[model samples]
Target: MIKKLLPFIGEYKLETILAPVMITIEVALELMIPFMMARIVDYGILGDGGMTYTIQMGSLMVLMAIIALIFGALSGRYAAIAGMGFAKNIREGLFKKIQTYSFANVDKFTTASLVTRLTTDVTNTQNSFMMVIRMAVRAPVMLIGATIMAVSINPQLSTVFIFSIPVLGTALYLIGKFAHPRFLDMLEKYDSLNEKVQDFIVNIRVVKAFVREDHEEEKFVDNAKRVKDAQLNAEKLVVLNMPIMQMTIYTSVVAILWFGGNMVIEGTFNIGELSSFIMYIMQVLISLMMLSMVFIMLIISRASFSRIVEGLEEKPVLDDGDADPQLKPENGDIEFKDVSFSYSDDAEHAVLNHVNLSIKSGETVGIIGGTGSSKSTLVQLIPRLYDVQSGEVHVAGRNVTQYKLNTLRDHVAMVLQNNVLFTGTIKENLKWGNEEATDEEVIEAAKAAQAHDFITAFPDGYDTELGQGGVNVSGGQKQRLTIARALLKQPKIVILDDSTSAVDTATDAAIREVFREHLNDVTTLIIAQRITSVSDADKIIVLEDGKINGFDTHDNLLKSNTIYQEIYESQSKGGGINE
Candidate 1:
């Protein structure tokens, strides 16, 4: 997991290397200051050396301190650069990986979970990375350096560390062992909290209309409290870290003071050497304290790092590695042979059964069914959005799996059941279909989708900016705008997945007419709730329980197919027969 994440350091390699080097230099120089102070006291003040030597040693100590400060600052600066750059690259990689995921892959991990991994989890990992580069090095070096100096001064006095150091180490190990699971539980609660908020926000309008704001607030509060409890549970164990250090720290100091005081009185150890030894003991204890803090950070971030790595290492549901790079879709022709698909592993609940169909280029077909007829599922196979569980789906005579995903999807445009528009001008959203589309091409596609007149009515015309999700437009207008965007692709195949249900019959009829005249060469499949929408098609398919119950001209289906008759009767009773 660590190896996979490290490669994202990319351009920050220099800073990653420099940060620890700078910190090592800083730690070394800082260690020398205490030794130099001991020289000033023992040699110059008490021994034969005069005040000049004291002043000289004092000046040298100050110079060392200044150099250490500069190096410390450089280490911090480098750590920040490396840490932030590593996180940025990780985010970019995660996002690009998500783009390649098949629909099945997306379903495996929910939206809220992915968002948490990208934001909060990444932040935690970044802080740990920077600390590891800086403090992780500093703590160990400081501890070893101080211990060596203290042992050199009085080997017997330094034994006090043996008892205190082991005690502190044991406490840290126990705390880390217990706190890891607590932190892991906390991050999962964060996912639940985020899901609660995201679900409420996406459906805010429905909540408002249903007068369920209080219900939502109560649910949110409950989830928020769970998150708080999980966090407190983890922190309570980590909070033990400092108190344990303090107890060990003060106990060692008291022992050193007592034994060394007796030694000083006997002239076995000089006052200056004792003073420097006490400083070294303090440094060693303080370094132990730093280690405890780093331990706590690593325990917490370990959970987050696991999550990020899990997401990063997830193989996309679809792989195009063996696909022919030059395999381009040349026509709108499509065929499905004995294809079977199930969202779950059980074959009894397959969303699409062994279905077979052939659609020729330029054929405009209508597909009619009840809610669970797998109308959308069938067309999704054509573009290779979801691969079949068994058998094959062919586009332009070649198996969809043979071509690169981009090559297959570029020629097949789909307007899904739930249309989405980003926060941008109408023209910008349309250009998503074709980035290089000319103004004339843009106007033509919009005109064909019956969006030009209403768009031109606005003051900004095509350049009018839309609010998020195109909230400024009505549902019907939003539908037409999505149609216009899809038409801009000029794709060889277009799938309208109940995309016109929001628009009125008149506008829907106009859009269909435009398809006939301008998109005549493209194979079009329309999924509709109303029979009139498909009543005039070149042919209509009636799907029942993932099987094709009937496929024929609209008139023949109405005459012979029971499922088609039932659908037509259900819709025509409203007096819009063949509208």
Candidate 2:
């Protein structure tokens, strides 16, 4: 895990080096302070009248204590800042990588899983990095220094140090190995819990409409309890390590005192030396405790690093088409010859099959079909949202696959069936279509989409914040705003996928009239379910089960096609269709 996270540190190598160096100095200073305390106790208070030596040693100890505190604080401050900055860079890099991924790659990892990776997992790795720098290096230095000092004081009693250190190391290793798998399980449970909560919030309206609040609560509780159980199991293993280590060190201390007491009575060991030995043993035990914490953090960080690598290594399925640089179409002529497409290899059937169509430049084409007739799927192919399995889709007189994606999409604009609005001002949303559009151009597009009147009535007008997903706006207003956004692009081709479904029939008619008058030079494709919606188009195509059944002008289709006549009759009987 340390190797994996090393690259994110980048130019902060100096900070990383300084943190450990400062910590080592602090540990050495701490060891000296304990020995000075023994000096103050044995020599200053009980020695032959020697005020000069006692005062000098005591003042030196105070100065060393102050220096230790300064180094410790500097080490902690630098480690924390470096860890936080490194984590921020990792998260930003991951987000940019995700943005470049195609739809197929994104589907491999769900939104909630990505969110967990970006936030909770990154935080875990960052905290571990901080702890390693702040304590991992200093602990070993303090332990080794204390051990050498104790052995030098009295080699006869050093046998207890060798016995206790090995026991502490073994106990920590065993507990860490057992707890590693449990921490990984806990991370998985957290992902599942996040997914459930996200789904509930997104579909809260449905849950309320069906009165399933209690059912959702039960589901959430079950997921939360699973996370709690995994966490508890891992914690039980980790908490046992501290006490076991303490017990081993305590036993060693008892043995040391027993041997050292005999030596004291036999006039072999000094009182000051024995006192310093006991203090060194305590320092070694605390150092072991810090080492144990480092190991536990390493286990948690390993799990988080795996998730980050998984996201970084994912491959986008869509390949960039090798496009011609000098290919520019003079008109918005479109053709699909024997087109067929399936979302994946395992899909049982194609969403579009052997479809054939042709539309002249600047023609208003209407696509009418029943539910699941693949109307939206057909239009999506023109923009290369999903490439066809066989056959060709030509746009502006060139194969779509042979044109650069940016160039091909630049000439086309689509308002999807599911209207989406970002959190921004009205003017900001419209400018998404054309970033450089002037205020005059924005208002013109809004009026063409029949959105100007309602927008002007708002207190802040175009500057009002829309809130998340435009929840502050009504459905009809949102659809019209989206249409205005698409209109501002001023593309050669426009596809409205049932965009006016929320407006009244009169408003829909007015919008269509505006399209005819102002956008006559641009080719328009309208996908709708209502017969009245497509009755005035220059051409209409009726689709059934992924195949075109009929294609003609509305007047000719009404006379020649029974399906068109039936749709018109049904809408007329229902006192006209809603927009």
Candidate 3:
């Protein structure tokens, strides 16, 4: 864990070094204050008792206190700035790394886990860094300085100091060993509780629709209880150290006073020296106690850091297409040659079997299948969302894997089944399709997708702020907006995966008509469950169990394709498409 954090601090090496240096200076000043107190008592008060010497020593003590306070304040300010900057750099780096991860890599770490790492885990590490620089350095310096001062004042009184050091060290080591595993468990419970709460909030509508509020509440309660219990156990182990250290400190102080009194009575040490020795011993022991607490915090932070490093170290399953050269295709043609894929290597079933297909430029094709028939999966492969397990996916007569991911995705625009709308104005969402697009271009795309009329009807028109996921808009409006966003891309190929399902049949027909007229030269692939939705396509492919069951024109398929015929007849008789 220390090794992982070293790189984040590397860029701030100057500040990191400077912060500890300032802390050391502050600790030295603090040590001098004690010595100054000893001087005032021994020489200024008990000596010939000259007014000049007393006044001089008293003035020196005031100067030392003021200097200590200034250095302490400087150290604190520098430590805070350095620690916060380190945390910001780390969080930004992690967020960028997450953006580069492939879909497969993202699936390995769930959204809830990522959120916890970005927030709670990073906060723990940041707190530890701040405490280490701000207080951890000073505690050790004070402890060692006080020990030296005590031994110098009277060697016989230093015996208690030596004994108390070992007792504190043992307590810190034992508490750290016990608390490390508990801290890891406690963080895991925290992530589980976060996941449960996120799920409940995101699916609140579903829960209300099904009247399962009590069920969800019970589930959340159970997860929260687990987190509470784990935290309590961790706190119990950590809090035990303080009382044990206090016991050692009190015992050592009692022994120091008892033994020092005997030495003073025997004339081996004077009253003033014994008093200074006891004061130094107390200072040393208290510093050790504070240091022990800092050590435990570092232990817990290390545990959290390990989890964060694990996420950063993960490699994306899909390569960035860096090693491969650019693929210059002959034309906008796509071919899937014996393609097979699965979500995982150990999965019992593949989502797509040995499927083969070819689509020429300027062609319109439709893919019809039941739920889980891999229609969406086939289109996802075109943009390389998932790598083919056993075959090649080619674009423009060249393998897609040979092109950079961004270059390939640039030519292929996809409107997914699950349409997502970010929090922004309608114009802003449309601009995501093409940032340089003019207002005229946006209006044209919106008109083609049959979204212009409704958008203009809104009070603010294109400037209206869309709520999260377009919650303020109807489902049909959201679908049309997504379609408009994709249309504005004007790519070589457009894939609409059941994009028109939310709109009424009349609106769907109008959008299809616009697509036919404006996108005549664009290669289009439509995946739909409604036979009426794809009946006008030049070709239709019916899929069953990951294999092509039939491939023909829609009219020809009505007679030759059993699956297509069944779907058509069912929908014609008021039986909705199964998917």
Go through the candidates in order and give each one's C-alpha lDDT.
0.91, 0.86, 0.85
Candidate 2 CA-lDDT value: 0.86
Error of 2 at 523 (Å): 3.2
User: Can you write out model 1's per-residue Cα lDDT over 305-334, one digit (the tens) per residue?
Assistant: 899898878898788899999988889998
lDDT of 1: 0.91
Q: Estimate each model's TM-score.
A: 0.97, 0.90, 0.95
Q: Model 3, 405-497: lDDT tens per residue? A: 887888888999988999999999999999999999999999999999999999999999998878889889998999899988878888999
Per-candidate clashes, comma-separated: 0, 0, 0
Worst 10 residues of 2 by lDDT: 313-322
Which stretches of candidate 2 lie above 4 Å from their native place? 38-49, 164-169, 321-331, 390-392, 397-408, 555-573, 576-579
Looking at model 1, which ten-residue stretch has the lowest summed lDDT?
570-579
Ranking by TM-score: 1, 3, 2
Which pairs in model 1 have colliding backbones? Answer: none
